[model samples]
Target: MEQLIKELESRARTLRYRIVKMIGPEEKGHLGGSCSIADVVTALYFHKMRHDPKQPKLRTRDRFLLSKGHAALVQYAALAECGYFPLSELDTLKELGSRLQGHPDMMKLPGVEANTGSLGQGLSIASGMAAALKLDGLDSKVYCVVGDGEMAEGQIWEAAMAASFYKLDNLVAILDRNGLQATGRIQERFNTNPVREKWESFGWHVLEIDGHDFAQIIEALDTADQVQGKPVMIIANTVKGKGIPFAEGVASFHNGTMTQEQFARACQLLEAEECEGR
Candidate 1:
């Protein structure tokens, strides 16, 4: 178990490295949310999800939707790491004619299941996919990662209600509860406290875990598979701008800029940790 966790941790660091590389000092991106969900995404793509990089559209492959689409860089990093596309293509991120856009585009990318970034809509999309798969009698599961800030959206609950009504047990939504949003703390902005209770009231199974912990993430996902008669919601407590000291828990870094020195320092810090772990 320790060895497995170490491998996942290393993959998370690599994903963070890719994120830093793609969103360089010259470009501003959703660094905080992306970093916050790095471990979760890493566990999914590298350890949990049944996906094939070479055959991204395979019907039997599990579907993953980044409902908090602003954090698409993390997903892109995982995809590139998974060999969905050449890592070199990531250099053109957010550029014109680049498949890697500011938000995920299902039509443009192979691994992206839904066109996201409008926020609050990806859950509904995932519910529909889950329902469709159920109707077709396919056991493929749908994994949707949502932002706690996006929980402010009315549509999320609506989708939550629908998932329960349909008993979409195959649908598992992981909430990135980093406590901070674009402007500031979620409570100061639009508090979505009692997140677990709210999802439970919606008639879904609820689980909470440390989002950055591979062991807990893996366990929660495993438990979700055994849950029946309802969809599962994992409320993951995470630190914003995780893995980088300057950015961790700093709300301003939600979409903050990085000076050349800051960027270099961030890179050095992450690399240093990776080396020490080795």
Candidate 2:
């Protein structure tokens, strides 16, 4: 277990570095949100999800959707690290003719399950996929990550109701409660506080944990498997711009740019983390 945690931690750092490298100084991408979900995405791809980079379309493989699609960089990093595609492809992110775009395009990318980034739509899409999988008698599970700010969408609640109504136990929704959204604190904007009670009231099984804690993440996912009658929701508490000293918890970094010096500093911090883990 200790070794597994170490491996996952190391993988998260690599993913973060790649994310920072992909969003160059000229174009500010979704840095804060992407960094916030790095640990969760790492855990899902490396430790939890049953997937194959070699056979992405293989039946019975687990599905992952980034509902808050602007955070596609993290998923792209994970996919590249997992061999879904060559790492060199990451260098052309958002470039014309590149599969790595600003948002995930299922048609263009091999590992991306849905075209996301508009926010509030991923849950509905995931619910439909979950229902379809169950209808076909497939045991595969569908996992969707939604941002706290995205929960303001009425469609999310509708999907939540539908999941519980159909008892889609194979559906697990992870809430990235990173507090701040693109503009500012979610509470100051579209507050979605008391998320736990809201989810419980929605008739779903809910678990809360430190998003960066590998052990807690692994345990919560395992427990979600044991839950039977309803879908599971893991409310992961995270920090925006995690792992970078200057960016951590700073809302401006949500889609902030990074100069060459800042990028170097980010790399240094991630490398330091890797060394400490070693």
Best by TM-score: 1
Please provide, for model 2 over 207-262, each residue's C-alpha lDDT reduced to its tens digit, 9 standing for 90 to 100.
Answer: 99999999999999999999998999999999998887788898989999887889
Worst 10 residues of 1 by lDDT: 20-29
Candidate 1 yields a Cα-based lDDT of 0.93
Clashes of each: 0, 0
lDDT of 1 at 143: 97
Alpha-carbon deviation at 133 in model 2, angstroms: 0.9
C-alpha TM-score for every candidate? 0.98, 0.98
lDDT of 1 by residue, 1-278 (tens): 89989999998998898888788895687899999999999999988899999999999889999999999999999999999999899999989999999999999998999999998999999999999999999999999999999999999989998999999999999999999988999999889998989999999999999999999999999999999999999999999999978899999889888889889988887888789778
Candidate 1 pairs with clashing backbones = none
